[model samples]
Target: MSNMIIEQEPDDELYEHYRFEAGKGQSPLRVDKFLMNLVENATRNKIQQAAAAGNIYVNDVPVKSNYKVKANDVVRVLLSHPPFEYLLEPENIPLNVVYEDDQLLVVNKEPGMVVHPGHGNYSGTLVNALAYHFENLPLNSSERPGLVHRIDKDTSGLLVVAKTEQAMAHLTKQFADKTSEREYIALVWGNVQEDEGTVEGHIGRHIKDRMQMAVFPDGSQGKHAVTHYKVLERFGYVTLVSCKLETGRTHQIRVHMKYIGHTLFNDARYGGDAILKGTTFSKYKQFIENCFKILPRQALHAKTLGFEHPVTREFLRFDTDLPEDMQDCIEKWGIYSKSHTIEEE
Candidate 1:
């Protein structure tokens, strides 16, 4: 939401801002999220509250949080309009529901599943599934509907969805407030020295590569990111660790681990496991011997998520076991990671 806000001080002491309402041929979208798209400077939290407070209108009718909008529905607001393409459409995809109510839907996202439709993808995303399920959430917008937060495409874990404006606002506010908790499990290439530790750095886009991110201090867009981790088990050269995210950003865990000198096994983009093949982890030679032994990508999984229900206001927590491939590697390599090393340059 903070990212959506635009800072405009004053102009001629009486500033003029643009505004518009959804019209026919447009699908229904969340009122708050709608304004987020229409008004480039408005936060989802702000719009959600505004809509809840009856500041938004669909065809001159005041709608509630979950109110479904129709195509070409008039959407009126009190702010200037933006011109960013926000196109999230519904597709028929299967979803594994862990919990659902009138307020939201919590689903177990599988590995390699893209959460949103963008760039190379125009369909086959979790957003499509949500659209299909909710049949056009209160977006009243043209871009991105029924989405509050996101996980990496390759990372598997629980994702919460907002079915209504109130639910979306509460969950998003919780993320901003740092009350909702998200923890992940990773099978790193080497063992950590102590039992537990934390990684902190300012994260932003890599200056050399627009597609990738890098760690920097006092950057223009980079923000502080932190991860708390404790060892779960040890292979001579490898270790299983549990990590909790203090802040969410693109590739935060992978980048932080690589920066700290403990990259995930087989993670080619970072410090890969090639070094451990003939050295330190000699005992795991046979373990890596089998073709299916080592996992393809860096082993990381979203294991736990906890938050207070937006509708019921009751605390809820969920957990998942480690993926099988990671478990196999740990069984063979844990407890013997003597070769794992972090050489700070």
Candidate 2:
């Protein structure tokens, strides 16, 4: 089987740094030695230190460096931090803190804020704000301090940040195991036929366009992703839906909905900005343009997030109201749909 490593370092937590499965007929070997052979630039001393720190796992159980690996044994290296890339400079950007504790905090992120710094976007990110607001927040495997998970830049919602190292590891594991719950409110281009449905496909970078994500139904490429959606409301042309993610991948909902012929409304990257479902009439076109102006970005918002508190182990869930832009757009659509119905009758 192929090893699973998230290379793109997308907008989510990185739990498993490296994973290896020994061959069926492989000879028994020391765990450190086995890893040194497979892991690039890994030394015996480093592996031993990771083992001593309880970061090495064999079949999901912590193992020492000297543990002997047998045939078909699975090995994993989990780290709380990834290789440091940028020197984060604290910026005094204001944050909307919903909840805070000694171990963690939840912030209601606004739209148009990038989660962390990357190429070209080396400043004005959430990480910079976190650095300024909180000193020495624990860094996740992506080297993003305090962030255990992330939503897209234009997708506003709640995100939990770890204040301590213990919280970081604990919360990261919850997300990697797919135990955490996240729900989003989305407006799509077409009227969805089903009230509830599930979309399953492997999501990876587009072959031709590196900036975009594509779905691979054959599982030949990318990581497995699933999105469960429920239709909340349907205008004559567009539909409002709620999507719950089973697996976190970059642009999972946007790509999966597009796969099902219902691209998210106003999602510029996925071609939702165009009037895909509306009429060819100039008035109808102007109405859609007005809605686009009301909601300049994708009509998707991270509405709810649920996870076990890292320190208390109590389940914590946070929900937020839809931003004004989305609400206004939806209301306009409702009015247009009703007026059109009256005219047709």
Candidate 3:
């Protein structure tokens, strides 16, 4: 909440900009971090704002805000022309509060509302809303406050948030230890060959691509992933299943479902039209195929979550009803089921 700025003339800004230098063959650090270290005079929030809005540049190129300094990566930061964006601005977005205590908060995140701010998304996030609600919520990570773990941008459901710093540390530890019970509901194409089973495999980065993840036989350095699931209901060809994570990894449920025979309906990444080719012509199946128009993303939701309260150490649990799009999909499935059965008979 300080307004101190460090501006410099274009020609002479080097070396002493930060208190610490790239020690002996090490790369330079991010401008904001370096500036924070050099002079405790200016607040870090001011420096970060300057860097993000292109007031700071690396090698005269407006580099990514996350760009770490490499050796000779020309560092030029102009704190004088700081963007007037505050570190924490409260937006009056409505939040669905499932449960709230002094220690933590349980929220039902709607589909398409991102959990936190990222590169292209800086506003309208769960954290943004929480910041608005709680005056000064502390976070596990310095950058992200009040977040222990996160659900995907499109996956709607129960999210546990820590309100206090002690709670944040404890809840984060639970997630890391896999003691946090995270349960999800997914509607996948076709009935799984087995009614109950687990997907156990090592997951790692896709060999060919950087943006996506894949299950490799020889698997990379990524940790072991396991998802335990049982059928919740069967709607004609589609099977609704309850999934619990034995091990949490990025896209663990989505990747494992696709690795097995059945993939979630409208999963553009793992489940493409190849599987849909068999299900097309069915009104419900086709609706799911063209689901980009109907639903925000795949038919997946973190429906339930349970964890030991960081402060109380008491077992805490919460659940959320399926979002509107999911309800719509279920209705279409029912309609398709009735007609398809009569035609077969």
Candidate 4:
């Protein structure tokens, strides 16, 4: 009996727990009984429940608890929730709520607030705040309470959270089916030539750097990601654009923009922190540095979000203004670009 246990969180919502390869000499046995013998602390009833939920798989197909495990068959267990690594602690953090009802709520999340607890960020997260504010916010498949989707910590924007299991399921399906609308405002380090364009590629973690995402143009690696961008304003060296997401992947906007030679301004992870486009003059360098100081992080914001209300089926859309830092940075660039263009003429 050869078996391997690999606990991994592939994405935000699914956890892959264990894999077993039955030996050649292995006799047929009920999968539930087999798992009870192998998986520690897993009761027969729990195994049945997981199987009923279609979390148990043999050769990548969902199987019932009574299915006989055959010799050389590959068995795997997947779960909606991860192993309880740490108890979620509710913190009394203030939230900027935009809209709320019995079924769901929309929050205008500010920059520098993490969406959930993970790694070094175990406290001071939006999840922690939600825990404190709401009672019994329904847990999604990933065991996260209320979250249907997430935006990056530094990307200020609107987020809708579900208050019930039905809301969670319906909203999750909307995002997965790409029926939910998500739009972002980004300032990138170049004058985007096209007024509007679409970027299609696969987005995955970088081969060398796990912290950053890279675009796989060949579709060989990563998840399919599409971003539609329309230029909103142009400075001499930078452009402000609105990006609509067709598929949400980690760092999709940053990676896709970088792939198209216009990295988001001050995006440290994607090499936008350095002045990628600008003159070499000391004044120009100082101006860019000041802009970086004002923004401090990637110049991207989840400015708009739209989706069908889970219970009512009414389409809901929310939009927000850019944060003060980004607004100030854009204003300075506008002034600089105008002055620079005059000098050139």
Tell me, by lDDT, which candidate is best: 2
Which one wins on TM-score?
Answer: 4
By TM-score, rank the candidates, best first.
Answer: 4, 2, 3, 1
lDDT of 4 by residue, 1-345 (tens): 222212122363434566788889889999999899898888999999999987787876778999999999988886665555437889999999999999999999989898887534667989999999999999876567998888877888899999998999999999999999999999998889999999999887566554467889999988899999999999868999999999988788988999999999998878999878765678788888998899998999999999999888999999999999999999998988878862462
Q: Across residues 140-195, which tens digit of lDDT does each residue of candidate 2 receive? A: 76566998888888888889999999999998899899999999999999889999
**Model 1 misplaced stretches (Cα beyond 4 Å):** 1-87, 138-143, 218-221, 271-294, 334-345
- In order of listing, the candidates' clash counts read 27, 0, 3, 0
Evaluation by lDDT, superior candidate among 1 and 3: 3
lDDT of 2 at 20: 85
- Model 3 agreement with the true structure over 1-345: per-residue lDDT tens digits: 133222111111111122233445655576667656665577878777766765555654555556687765545554333235535556778999889989888899988897765423567888789888886677554345787777777789988888888888898889879898989999887767688999988876554443346787555555688999998887767788999998777678888888897788777767543445334456544565555456657889998899998877899888778888987877777776667752352
The true-versus-predicted C-alpha distance at residue 333 of model 3, in Å, is 1.0
What's the CA error at residue 234 for candidate 3, in Å? Answer: 2.2
Better of 3 and 4 by lDDT: 4
In candidate 4, residue 193 scores what lDDT? 94
lDDT string for model 1 (319-342, tens) is: 887777666666655433344333
Question: Candidates' lDDT values, in order?
Answer: 0.66, 0.85, 0.70, 0.84
